[model samples]
Target: MQFDAILKQKDEIIQQLQSQINPLKNLVEQLLAEVKLLREQNAALLELIKEKDKRIQKLELVEHQYHQLTKLVYGRSSEKTSTALPGQLSLGIDAELVEACNINDGQKIESYTKIKSEKKKHPGRNEIPAHLERKYIDIHPENLPADARTLRYNRNRTIGI
Candidate 1:
Protein backbone atom coordinates (compact mmCIF):
# COMPACT_ATOMS: atom_id res chain seq x y z
CA MET A 1 0.00 0.00 0.00
CA GLN A 2 2.83 2.39 0.64
CA PHE A 3 4.42 1.76 -2.76
CA ASP A 4 1.05 2.29 -4.52
CA ALA A 5 0.59 5.69 -2.80
CA ILE A 6 4.06 6.87 -3.94
CA LEU A 7 3.40 5.79 -7.50
CA LYS A 8 -0.01 7.59 -7.50
CA GLN A 9 1.56 10.86 -6.26
CA LYS A 10 4.17 10.82 -9.11
CA ASP A 11 1.41 10.24 -11.70
CA GLU A 12 -0.65 13.20 -10.41
CA ILE A 13 2.38 15.58 -10.58
CA ILE A 14 3.16 14.49 -14.19
CA GLN A 15 -0.51 15.12 -15.20
CA GLN A 16 -0.43 18.70 -13.83
CA LEU A 17 2.87 19.48 -15.67
CA GLN A 18 1.46 18.07 -18.98
CA SER A 19 -1.68 20.24 -18.61
CA GLN A 20 0.47 23.42 -18.12
CA ILE A 21 2.92 22.54 -20.96
CA ASN A 22 0.09 22.20 -23.60
CA PRO A 23 -1.05 25.89 -23.33
CA LEU A 24 2.56 27.17 -23.32
CA LYS A 25 3.32 25.20 -26.50
CA ASN A 26 0.29 26.71 -28.25
CA LEU A 27 1.40 30.25 -27.24
CA VAL A 28 4.90 29.65 -28.61
CA GLU A 29 3.45 28.42 -31.97
CA GLN A 30 1.28 31.56 -32.27
CA LEU A 31 4.28 33.85 -31.61
CA LEU A 32 6.36 32.03 -34.26
CA ALA A 33 3.61 32.55 -36.89
CA GLU A 34 3.51 36.33 -36.12
CA VAL A 35 7.31 36.59 -36.55
CA LYS A 36 7.18 34.79 -39.93
CA LEU A 37 4.45 37.16 -41.17
CA LEU A 38 6.44 40.26 -40.14
CA ARG A 39 9.57 38.95 -41.94
CA GLU A 40 7.62 38.37 -45.16
CA GLN A 41 6.19 41.93 -45.08
CA ASN A 42 9.65 43.40 -44.49
CA ALA A 43 11.10 41.52 -47.47
CA ALA A 44 8.27 42.72 -49.73
CA LEU A 45 8.79 46.33 -48.69
CA LEU A 46 12.56 46.10 -49.40
CA GLU A 47 11.90 44.74 -52.90
CA LEU A 48 9.49 47.63 -53.59
CA ILE A 49 12.10 50.21 -52.48
CA LYS A 50 14.74 48.68 -54.75
CA GLU A 51 12.43 48.89 -57.74
CA LYS A 52 11.61 52.54 -56.98
CA ASP A 53 15.32 53.43 -56.71
CA LYS A 54 16.05 51.83 -60.07
CA ARG A 55 13.20 53.80 -61.68
CA ILE A 56 14.47 57.06 -60.18
CA GLN A 57 17.94 56.42 -61.59
CA LYS A 58 16.50 55.77 -65.03
CA LEU A 59 14.50 59.02 -64.89
CA GLU A 60 17.60 60.98 -63.88
CA LEU A 61 19.55 59.52 -66.78
CA VAL A 62 16.80 60.56 -69.19
CA GLU A 63 16.72 64.08 -67.75
CA HIS A 64 20.51 64.41 -68.14
CA GLN A 65 20.30 63.29 -71.77
CA TYR A 66 17.58 65.87 -72.46
CA HIS A 67 19.68 68.61 -70.92
CA GLN A 68 22.66 67.76 -73.13
CA LEU A 69 20.48 67.73 -76.23
CA THR A 70 18.98 71.14 -75.43
CA LYS A 71 22.44 72.64 -74.88
CA LEU A 72 23.57 71.33 -78.27
CA VAL A 73 20.47 72.70 -80.02
CA TYR A 74 19.86 76.09 -78.31
CA GLY A 75 23.26 77.19 -76.99
CA ARG A 76 25.44 79.87 -78.63
CA SER A 77 26.78 78.83 -82.02
CA SER A 78 30.53 78.34 -82.67
CA GLU A 79 30.07 79.99 -86.12
CA LYS A 80 33.36 78.39 -87.31
CA THR A 81 33.59 77.15 -90.88
CA SER A 82 36.12 76.65 -93.70
CA THR A 83 36.74 79.75 -95.84
CA ALA A 84 34.67 79.82 -99.05
CA LEU A 85 36.40 79.46 -102.44
CA PRO A 86 36.98 82.68 -104.44
CA GLY A 87 34.19 83.63 -106.98
CA GLN A 88 32.05 80.75 -105.64
CA LEU A 89 29.22 82.80 -104.15
CA SER A 90 26.04 81.54 -102.50
CA LEU A 91 23.34 84.03 -103.50
CA GLY A 92 20.65 82.12 -101.54
CA ILE A 93 18.22 82.70 -104.47
CA ASP A 94 16.81 79.89 -106.55
CA ALA A 95 19.12 78.57 -109.29
CA GLU A 96 16.69 79.60 -112.09
CA LEU A 97 16.40 83.20 -110.77
CA VAL A 98 20.18 83.48 -110.37
CA GLU A 99 20.76 82.23 -113.93
CA ALA A 100 18.30 84.82 -115.30
CA CYS A 101 20.20 87.64 -113.50
CA ASN A 102 23.71 86.32 -114.18
CA ILE A 103 26.14 88.68 -115.93
CA ASN A 104 28.16 87.68 -118.97
CA ASP A 105 31.85 86.87 -118.37
CA GLY A 106 33.19 89.39 -120.96
CA GLN A 107 30.66 92.26 -120.71
CA LYS A 108 31.51 95.34 -118.61
CA ILE A 109 28.96 96.67 -116.15
CA GLU A 110 28.16 100.40 -116.04
CA SER A 111 30.05 102.32 -113.37
CA TYR A 112 28.50 104.64 -110.81
CA THR A 113 29.97 107.96 -109.49
CA LYS A 114 30.12 108.58 -105.73
CA ILE A 115 29.72 112.11 -104.25
CA LYS A 116 32.94 113.47 -102.63
CA SER A 117 33.47 116.23 -100.05
CA GLU A 118 36.23 118.94 -100.20
CA LYS A 119 37.62 121.06 -97.33
CA LYS A 120 36.91 124.85 -97.70
CA LYS A 121 39.92 127.11 -98.46
CA HIS A 122 41.01 129.55 -95.69
CA PRO A 123 39.53 133.07 -96.27
CA GLY A 124 41.87 136.08 -96.03
CA ARG A 125 41.93 138.33 -92.91
CA ASN A 126 38.49 139.53 -91.80
CA GLU A 127 37.77 143.28 -91.39
CA ILE A 128 37.16 144.49 -87.81
CA PRO A 129 33.53 145.23 -86.90
CA ALA A 130 32.74 148.96 -87.26
CA HIS A 131 31.04 148.94 -83.82
CA LEU A 132 34.30 148.17 -81.90
CA GLU A 133 35.78 151.10 -79.84
CA ARG A 134 39.51 151.89 -80.49
CA LYS A 135 41.83 153.20 -77.75
CA TYR A 136 45.56 154.12 -78.18
CA ILE A 137 48.21 154.33 -75.43
CA ASP A 138 51.67 156.14 -75.64
CA ILE A 139 54.44 153.81 -74.34
CA HIS A 140 57.02 156.65 -73.82
CA PRO A 141 59.19 156.13 -70.69
CA GLU A 142 59.22 158.86 -67.96
CA ASN A 143 63.05 158.52 -67.21
CA LEU A 144 64.20 158.96 -70.86
CA PRO A 145 67.01 161.53 -71.67
CA ALA A 146 65.97 164.99 -72.91
CA ASP A 147 67.40 164.18 -76.43
CA ALA A 148 65.46 160.83 -76.71
CA ARG A 149 63.40 160.74 -79.91
CA THR A 150 60.00 159.04 -80.46
CA LEU A 151 59.58 155.97 -82.72
CA ARG A 152 56.59 154.41 -84.47
CA TYR A 153 54.55 152.19 -82.11
CA ASN A 154 53.22 148.66 -82.94
CA ARG A 155 49.43 148.29 -83.37
CA ASN A 156 48.35 145.05 -81.53
CA ARG A 157 45.12 144.05 -79.70
CA THR A 158 44.63 141.97 -76.52
CA ILE A 159 41.91 139.33 -76.21
CA GLY A 160 39.99 141.53 -73.70
CA ILE A 161 40.20 144.51 -76.09
Candidate 2:
Protein backbone atom coordinates (compact mmCIF):
# COMPACT_ATOMS: atom_id res chain seq x y z
CA MET A 1 0.00 0.00 0.00
CA GLN A 2 2.86 2.44 0.88
CA PHE A 3 4.58 1.90 -2.50
CA ASP A 4 1.33 2.53 -4.36
CA ALA A 5 0.82 5.86 -2.56
CA ILE A 6 4.38 7.10 -3.47
CA LEU A 7 3.81 6.18 -7.11
CA LYS A 8 0.51 8.11 -7.20
CA GLN A 9 2.15 11.29 -5.69
CA LYS A 10 4.97 11.16 -8.25
CA ASP A 11 2.44 10.94 -11.09
CA GLU A 12 0.51 13.97 -9.78
CA ILE A 13 3.69 16.13 -9.55
CA ILE A 14 4.67 15.21 -13.12
CA GLN A 15 1.22 16.13 -14.41
CA GLN A 16 1.35 19.58 -12.66
CA LEU A 17 4.77 20.39 -14.12
CA GLN A 18 3.57 19.55 -17.66
CA SER A 19 0.51 21.80 -17.28
CA GLN A 20 2.64 24.82 -16.23
CA ILE A 21 5.27 24.20 -18.91
CA ASN A 22 2.77 24.01 -21.78
CA PRO A 23 1.47 27.56 -21.17
CA LEU A 24 5.02 28.90 -20.76
CA LYS A 25 6.07 27.36 -24.07
CA ASN A 26 3.12 29.00 -25.88
CA LEU A 27 3.95 32.39 -24.30
CA VAL A 28 7.54 32.25 -25.58
CA GLU A 29 6.37 31.58 -29.15
CA GLN A 30 4.03 34.58 -29.07
CA LEU A 31 6.85 36.83 -27.84
CA LEU A 32 9.09 35.75 -30.73
CA ALA A 33 6.40 36.53 -33.30
CA GLU A 34 5.84 40.00 -31.85
CA VAL A 35 9.57 40.71 -32.01
CA LYS A 36 9.67 39.78 -35.71
CA LEU A 37 6.73 42.09 -36.50
CA LEU A 38 8.42 45.03 -34.75
CA ARG A 39 11.64 44.48 -36.73
CA GLU A 40 9.76 44.64 -40.05
CA GLN A 41 8.04 47.88 -39.03
CA ASN A 42 11.36 49.43 -38.10
CA ALA A 43 12.81 48.58 -41.54
CA ALA A 44 9.86 50.25 -43.31
CA LEU A 45 10.32 53.41 -41.24
CA LEU A 46 14.01 53.56 -42.16
CA GLU A 47 13.18 53.42 -45.89
CA LEU A 48 10.70 56.28 -45.54
CA ILE A 49 13.30 58.39 -43.77
CA LYS A 50 15.80 57.83 -46.60
CA GLU A 51 13.26 59.03 -49.20
CA LYS A 52 12.56 62.22 -47.27
CA ASP A 53 16.26 62.92 -46.90
CA LYS A 54 16.77 62.78 -50.67
CA ARG A 55 13.95 65.26 -51.33
CA ILE A 56 15.31 67.64 -48.71
CA GLN A 57 18.78 67.52 -50.26
CA LYS A 58 17.41 68.34 -53.69
CA LEU A 59 15.48 71.35 -52.40
CA GLU A 60 18.52 72.65 -50.57
CA LEU A 61 20.57 72.55 -53.78
CA VAL A 62 17.94 74.52 -55.73
CA GLU A 63 17.76 77.09 -52.97
CA HIS A 64 21.53 77.46 -53.04
CA GLN A 65 21.47 78.03 -56.82
CA TYR A 66 18.74 80.61 -56.41
CA HIS A 67 20.80 82.45 -53.83
CA GLN A 68 23.83 82.53 -56.12
CA LEU A 69 21.76 83.84 -59.06
CA THR A 70 20.28 86.53 -56.85
CA LYS A 71 23.69 87.71 -55.80
CA LEU A 72 24.77 87.95 -59.42
CA VAL A 73 21.67 89.90 -60.51
CA TYR A 74 21.21 92.35 -57.63
CA GLY A 75 24.96 92.85 -56.92
CA ARG A 76 24.51 92.32 -53.19
CA SER A 77 24.69 89.69 -50.50
CA SER A 78 21.61 87.68 -49.41
CA GLU A 79 21.33 89.39 -46.02
CA LYS A 80 21.13 92.91 -47.48
CA THR A 81 17.55 93.03 -48.78
CA SER A 82 14.23 91.43 -47.84
CA THR A 83 12.68 92.22 -51.24
CA ALA A 84 13.71 89.88 -54.06
CA LEU A 85 12.36 88.48 -57.31
CA PRO A 86 11.08 84.89 -57.14
CA GLY A 87 13.53 82.10 -57.99
CA GLN A 88 12.21 81.23 -61.47
CA LEU A 89 11.34 84.82 -62.37
CA SER A 90 14.98 85.78 -62.03
CA LEU A 91 15.74 83.34 -64.82
CA GLY A 92 13.26 85.15 -67.09
CA ILE A 93 14.70 88.53 -66.18
CA ASP A 94 18.24 87.31 -66.73
CA ALA A 95 17.20 86.31 -70.22
CA GLU A 96 15.12 89.45 -70.93
CA LEU A 97 15.94 92.33 -68.55
CA VAL A 98 18.27 94.84 -70.25
CA GLU A 99 19.99 97.94 -68.95
CA ALA A 100 17.57 100.37 -70.65
CA CYS A 101 15.26 101.99 -68.03
CA ASN A 102 14.95 98.79 -65.96
CA ILE A 103 13.45 95.61 -67.49
CA ASN A 104 9.87 96.44 -68.66
CA ASP A 105 10.57 99.27 -71.12
CA GLY A 106 11.30 96.87 -73.98
CA GLN A 107 8.23 94.80 -73.14
CA LYS A 108 6.02 97.92 -73.11
CA ILE A 109 7.40 99.02 -76.48
CA GLU A 110 6.53 95.69 -78.07
CA SER A 111 2.98 95.74 -76.66
CA TYR A 112 2.39 99.31 -77.81
CA THR A 113 3.48 98.44 -81.33
CA LYS A 114 1.08 95.51 -81.48
CA ILE A 115 -1.88 97.60 -80.23
CA LYS A 116 -1.17 100.41 -82.70
CA SER A 117 -1.00 97.98 -85.62
CA GLU A 118 -4.32 96.43 -84.59
CA LYS A 119 -5.96 99.90 -84.33
CA LYS A 120 -4.84 100.81 -87.86
CA LYS A 121 -6.34 97.61 -89.30
CA HIS A 122 -9.79 98.15 -87.65
CA PRO A 123 -10.77 101.83 -87.45
CA GLY A 124 -14.21 101.60 -85.81
CA ARG A 125 -13.05 98.78 -83.53
CA ASN A 126 -10.20 100.95 -82.31
CA GLU A 127 -12.59 103.49 -80.73
CA ILE A 128 -12.20 103.25 -76.96
CA PRO A 129 -15.42 102.38 -75.14
CA ALA A 130 -16.58 104.72 -72.38
CA HIS A 131 -16.08 101.99 -69.75
CA LEU A 132 -12.63 101.06 -71.07
CA GLU A 133 -11.22 104.55 -71.27
CA ARG A 134 -9.78 105.61 -67.90
CA LYS A 135 -7.03 107.86 -66.60
CA TYR A 136 -3.71 106.07 -66.15
CA ILE A 137 -1.84 106.50 -62.86
CA ASP A 138 1.28 104.91 -61.43
CA ILE A 139 1.62 104.07 -57.74
CA HIS A 140 5.15 104.69 -56.43
CA PRO A 141 6.87 102.25 -54.08
CA GLU A 142 8.02 103.52 -50.69
CA ASN A 143 10.95 101.16 -50.09
CA LEU A 144 12.64 100.63 -53.48
CA PRO A 145 14.23 103.34 -55.59
CA ALA A 146 12.37 105.06 -58.45
CA ASP A 147 13.47 102.65 -61.19
CA ALA A 148 13.23 99.34 -59.30
CA ARG A 149 10.27 96.93 -59.50
CA THR A 150 9.75 93.61 -57.75
CA LEU A 151 8.98 90.53 -59.85
CA ARG A 152 8.31 87.26 -58.04
CA TYR A 153 8.18 83.66 -59.32
CA ASN A 154 7.55 80.37 -57.55
CA ARG A 155 10.08 77.55 -57.96
CA ASN A 156 8.85 74.38 -59.71
CA ARG A 157 9.49 71.41 -57.44
CA THR A 158 9.77 68.97 -60.34
CA ILE A 159 13.26 67.82 -61.26
CA GLY A 160 15.04 69.30 -64.34
CA ILE A 161 12.97 72.41 -65.37
Candidate 3:
Protein backbone atom coordinates (compact mmCIF):
# COMPACT_ATOMS: atom_id res chain seq x y z
CA MET A 1 0.00 0.00 0.00
CA GLN A 2 2.91 2.50 0.78
CA PHE A 3 4.50 1.71 -2.58
CA ASP A 4 1.17 2.43 -4.30
CA ALA A 5 0.96 5.83 -2.60
CA ILE A 6 4.56 6.66 -3.62
CA LEU A 7 3.80 5.71 -7.23
CA LYS A 8 0.72 7.94 -7.20
CA GLN A 9 2.81 10.87 -5.86
CA LYS A 10 5.49 10.36 -8.55
CA ASP A 11 2.84 10.46 -11.28
CA GLU A 12 1.35 13.70 -9.92
CA ILE A 13 4.82 15.39 -9.84
CA ILE A 14 5.47 14.33 -13.49
CA GLN A 15 2.10 15.78 -14.59
CA GLN A 16 2.91 19.16 -12.90
CA LEU A 17 6.37 19.31 -14.54
CA GLN A 18 4.84 18.54 -17.99
CA SER A 19 2.27 21.29 -17.55
CA GLN A 20 5.04 23.84 -16.78
CA ILE A 21 7.21 22.68 -19.72
CA ASN A 22 4.32 23.06 -22.24
CA PRO A 23 4.16 26.89 -21.89
CA LEU A 24 7.98 27.21 -21.97
CA LYS A 25 8.10 25.16 -25.23
CA ASN A 26 5.44 27.38 -26.77
CA LEU A 27 7.41 30.57 -25.76
CA VAL A 28 10.63 29.16 -27.24
CA GLU A 29 8.85 28.42 -30.58
CA GLN A 30 7.42 31.97 -30.72
CA LEU A 31 10.90 33.48 -30.12
CA LEU A 32 12.39 31.33 -32.89
CA ALA A 33 9.68 32.48 -35.34
CA GLU A 34 10.35 36.14 -34.44
CA VAL A 35 14.09 35.71 -35.01
CA LYS A 36 13.48 34.12 -38.45
CA LEU A 37 11.15 36.99 -39.48
CA LEU A 38 13.75 39.58 -38.39
CA ARG A 39 16.45 37.86 -40.42
CA GLU A 40 14.24 37.91 -43.54
CA GLN A 41 13.51 41.63 -43.06
CA ASN A 42 17.24 42.37 -42.65
CA ALA A 43 18.07 40.57 -45.89
CA ALA A 44 15.31 42.38 -47.80
CA LEU A 45 16.45 45.77 -46.48
CA LEU A 46 20.05 45.04 -47.45
CA GLU A 47 18.99 44.18 -50.98
CA LEU A 48 17.01 47.41 -51.20
CA ILE A 49 20.03 49.37 -50.01
CA LYS A 50 22.20 47.73 -52.66
CA GLU A 51 19.68 48.54 -55.37
CA LYS A 52 19.49 52.20 -54.23
CA ASP A 53 23.29 52.44 -54.26
CA LYS A 54 23.38 51.18 -57.83
CA ARG A 55 20.68 53.65 -58.87
CA ILE A 56 22.57 56.54 -57.21
CA GLN A 57 25.74 55.60 -59.06
CA LYS A 58 23.87 55.53 -62.38
CA LEU A 59 22.25 58.92 -61.66
CA GLU A 60 25.62 60.45 -60.80
CA LEU A 61 27.11 59.19 -64.07
CA VAL A 62 24.14 60.61 -66.03
CA GLU A 63 24.44 63.97 -64.24
CA HIS A 64 28.15 64.11 -65.06
CA GLN A 65 27.40 63.41 -68.74
CA TYR A 66 24.68 66.10 -68.74
CA HIS A 67 27.08 68.69 -67.30
CA GLN A 68 29.71 67.77 -69.90
CA LEU A 69 27.15 68.14 -72.71
CA THR A 70 25.98 71.49 -71.35
CA LYS A 71 29.55 72.78 -71.14
CA LEU A 72 30.24 71.64 -74.72
CA VAL A 73 27.12 73.43 -75.95
CA TYR A 74 27.42 76.73 -74.01
CA GLY A 75 31.10 77.09 -73.13
CA ARG A 76 33.82 78.98 -75.06
CA SER A 77 34.34 77.74 -78.64
CA SER A 78 37.85 79.10 -79.34
CA GLU A 79 40.75 76.71 -78.67
CA LYS A 80 44.50 77.13 -79.33
CA THR A 81 45.83 74.53 -81.77
CA SER A 82 48.82 72.26 -80.91
CA THR A 83 49.86 71.91 -84.57
CA ALA A 84 53.65 72.25 -85.14
CA LEU A 85 54.43 75.54 -86.93
CA PRO A 86 57.43 76.34 -89.21
CA GLY A 87 60.18 76.85 -86.56
CA GLN A 88 58.69 74.64 -83.79
CA LEU A 89 60.18 71.27 -82.85
CA SER A 90 58.65 68.48 -84.91
CA LEU A 91 57.59 65.83 -82.43
CA GLY A 92 56.40 62.43 -83.73
CA ILE A 93 54.54 63.78 -86.77
CA ASP A 94 57.76 64.10 -88.87
CA ALA A 95 58.37 60.33 -88.72
CA GLU A 96 54.72 59.65 -89.71
CA LEU A 97 55.00 62.25 -92.51
CA VAL A 98 58.22 60.70 -93.86
CA GLU A 99 56.64 57.23 -93.77
CA ALA A 100 53.54 58.50 -95.54
CA CYS A 101 55.61 60.36 -98.20
CA ASN A 102 57.68 57.22 -98.83
CA ILE A 103 54.56 55.10 -99.13
CA ASN A 104 52.82 57.64 -101.41
CA ASP A 105 55.92 58.40 -103.56
CA GLY A 106 56.54 62.05 -102.52
CA GLN A 107 53.02 63.54 -102.44
CA LYS A 108 53.07 67.35 -102.22
CA ILE A 109 51.62 68.91 -99.00
CA GLU A 110 49.25 71.88 -99.29
CA SER A 111 48.26 74.44 -96.61
CA TYR A 112 44.93 76.27 -96.39
CA THR A 113 43.92 79.37 -94.38
CA LYS A 114 40.58 81.03 -93.53
CA ILE A 115 39.83 84.51 -94.84
CA LYS A 116 39.85 87.45 -92.32
CA SER A 117 36.76 89.66 -91.84
CA GLU A 118 36.23 92.94 -89.96
CA LYS A 119 34.60 92.76 -86.52
CA LYS A 120 31.35 94.69 -85.85
CA LYS A 121 31.55 97.56 -83.34
CA HIS A 122 29.51 97.31 -80.08
CA PRO A 123 28.18 100.74 -78.91
CA GLY A 124 28.22 100.93 -75.10
CA ARG A 125 25.57 103.55 -74.06
CA ASN A 126 22.57 105.46 -75.48
CA GLU A 127 23.30 108.83 -77.05
CA ILE A 128 21.80 112.01 -75.48
CA PRO A 129 18.86 113.51 -77.35
CA ALA A 130 19.72 116.67 -79.34
CA HIS A 131 16.10 118.04 -79.16
CA LEU A 132 16.17 118.70 -75.40
CA GLU A 133 15.97 122.41 -74.37
CA ARG A 134 19.14 123.86 -72.74
CA LYS A 135 19.29 126.77 -70.25
CA TYR A 136 22.60 128.66 -69.71
CA ILE A 137 23.47 130.87 -66.70
CA ASP A 138 26.58 133.04 -66.56
CA ILE A 139 28.15 134.40 -63.35
CA HIS A 140 30.56 137.37 -63.18
CA PRO A 141 33.16 137.95 -60.44
CA GLU A 142 31.65 139.86 -57.47
CA ASN A 143 34.55 142.31 -56.76
CA LEU A 144 36.11 142.60 -60.21
CA PRO A 145 36.41 145.49 -62.74
CA ALA A 146 34.39 145.26 -65.99
CA ASP A 147 37.44 144.06 -67.92
CA ALA A 148 38.29 141.47 -65.13
CA ARG A 149 34.61 140.44 -64.94
CA THR A 150 34.85 139.24 -68.54
CA LEU A 151 37.96 137.15 -67.60
CA ARG A 152 36.16 135.66 -64.51
CA TYR A 153 32.89 134.82 -66.20
CA ASN A 154 31.64 131.28 -65.40
CA ARG A 155 28.98 129.56 -67.55
CA ASN A 156 26.85 126.47 -66.82
CA ARG A 157 24.18 124.71 -68.92
CA THR A 158 21.26 122.72 -67.49
CA ILE A 159 18.83 120.67 -69.58
CA GLY A 160 15.20 121.78 -69.02
CA ILE A 161 12.70 119.17 -67.84
In model 2, what is the error at residue 37, expressed in angstroms? Answer: 0.7
lDDT of each: 0.77, 0.69, 0.73
Model 1 lDDT per residue over 1-161, tens place: 99999999999999999999989999999999999999999999999998897678667778976876676677655522322447888757553464456466558879999998998899989998899997888676678788876575656543321
Q: What is the TM-score of candidate 3?
A: 0.40
lDDT of 1 at 142: 79
How does candidate 1 fare on TM-score? 0.39
Better of 2 and 3 by TM-score: 2
Model 3 residue 138 CA deviation in Å = 59
Q: Write the per-residue lDDT of candidate 3 for residues 1-161, one digit (tens) a residue.
A: 99999999999999999999989999999999999999999999999998897678667778976876676667665421333457887655443354346555657889899898988899889877899876656554477665542433334333332
lDDT of 3: 0.73
lDDT of 2 by residue, 6-119 (tens): 999999999999999989999999999999999999999999998887678667778988986677777666544544556634434331133224544445434334444344
Q: Which 10 successive residues of model 3 have the least lDDT summed? A: 152-161
Q: Number of clashing residue pairs in every model?
A: 0, 1, 0
- List residue ranges in candidate 2 displaced over 4 A: 1-6, 76-161
Ranked by lDDT, top first: 1, 3, 2
Lowest summed lDDT window (length 10), candidate 2: 91-100
Our tally of clashes for model 2 stands at: 1
Clashing pairs in 1: none
By TM-score, the candidates rank as 2, 3, 1
